[model samples]
Target: MDLRFDHLIHAVSDPERARHAFADRFGWHTVAGGEHPGFATYNALAYFGLPYIEWVGVRKPEVAAERPFGRDVLRVLRAGEGPMQFAVRTNDIVGMADRWSRAGLVHEGPIEASRVRPDGVTLRWRMLFPAQEPGKLLLPFVIEWPAPDEVRLADLRQSGLSPDPAAAPRLRAVHAVVGDLARLRRSMDAYFPGVLEPCESSEQGRGVRWTCGEVTVFVWEPAEGALRRVLDTVGERPFLAEFERTAGVRTRTAADAARRLEAAGAPVHGLWVVTSE
Candidate 1:
């Protein structure tokens, strides 16, 4: 039941504008995504590898108001376009659900869902949403695709959807600015058991870093600083997505990072964060 960071969901007012924004911001190849059959939402996508960016917008307000996930998207968009959610890829979703039950964590389905691709092909999968807990950052939903993870990666390459890992700046981490970083770290241990590790305090603030093979999730709570202001403003949410820079990327101050994060609200393309390391 090993899980890896899968993709970031960015909520937007318009999916097409988001696609163009990603193209302009990172020079990433974007696709014109299609509608989800039941959710009343549509998407625009940009793939760096397995962990891609999904820009989702409400297509039918009445229908969207009926679905919980759709309502979540609408709530995020009301605050303006920004990173909305994250999900992990898993192979054994049933086992994961059992584990969650044993751990005393509440969860909703291994629900079956599908989106009809613009090319008229249907892509199906199952998702399990872990309820968000107090004092913890938002819990990432778990996704189990129809094929094995490697098979999906290969298919993405063959379909010309994902760029080669070495050539593209694949998503490296999702950084959350939240209150009580220590409590969030403890909560993650309950959900993920021992994968999260200690991270040093720096321009990124102080928190724990969780790695699930390919991508990392960082939770930070700074003392009266830019990151703290973010928590005060947005409450607990993922504020920045780090991507591997091809060259000349160095760390910046929290103020600079916060400024870049503000820039992310427009058009909903993820903000670029890279470390010299």
Candidate 2:
């Protein structure tokens, strides 16, 4: 069972605004991502190599309010803008869902989902969402892309999105805020065995880190109001902060990114600066 980090979902009030803000701060342009039709949501995508950033928001409140997942995303937007959830990709989605079911973990679907690009090419995939729980937000939803691994990047480029492989910041790690470290570790072990390792945080707390291909995921105790919202709704969600490692030695610091975000008027809570070697 090999699970790879797919993309990070950042819920914002305006996908276009979020896209421009990201461009201003990171120097990477986001291409137009089409609407979710029946779900009443749409997105703009900032593509990296494999993992990317998806800035999603509601286009129609009434229709989106009808669905549980749609409503969940909308709630995050209502609270403010920042990361709401992340996803993991697998080649065998059905097998993965079976494993979760056998473990007594409740989940929904291998649901068929698709989006039509502006060029009229439709990209389709299947997804599985875990049953909502205290730490459910910390757990990634499973996704299976139909295309072969090698052509995934090319497919995105063909869909009329500009993915600057050279300028796009590589995702270094995803920081998840959880209540109980031991319990989350147990769940992760069952889903993807032998991936996590105990680690120390620079912020004076303990955390567990795991690598899925090129990206690292860190789960630690909630540190801010935004993180606490992962368990509630008033603040934000499980994604406390995201760190990016740039391609150059003089990449922008967190403070620089914060200033850029502030100037752009985007929510700066869950986003950190880009670090470089």
Best by TM-score: 1
Model 2 poorest ten-residue lDDT run: 248-257
Q: Each model's number of backbone clashes?
A: 0, 0
Local accuracy by lDDT, each model = 0.73, 0.67
Q: What's model 1's TM-score?
A: 0.85
Candidate 2 residue runs with Cα over 4 Å from true position: 134-136, 158-162, 201-203, 222-270
Which candidate leads the pack in lDDT? 1
Q: Which pairs of residues collide in candidate 2? A: none
Please give the lDDT score at residue 194 for candidate 1.
Answer: 84
Local accuracy of candidate 1 as per-residue lDDT tens digits, 54-171: 8899999888988857878877777767777788888899898999899898888888889877677689999988877733327788898998878888988888788766767867
TM-scores, all candidates, are: 0.85, 0.81
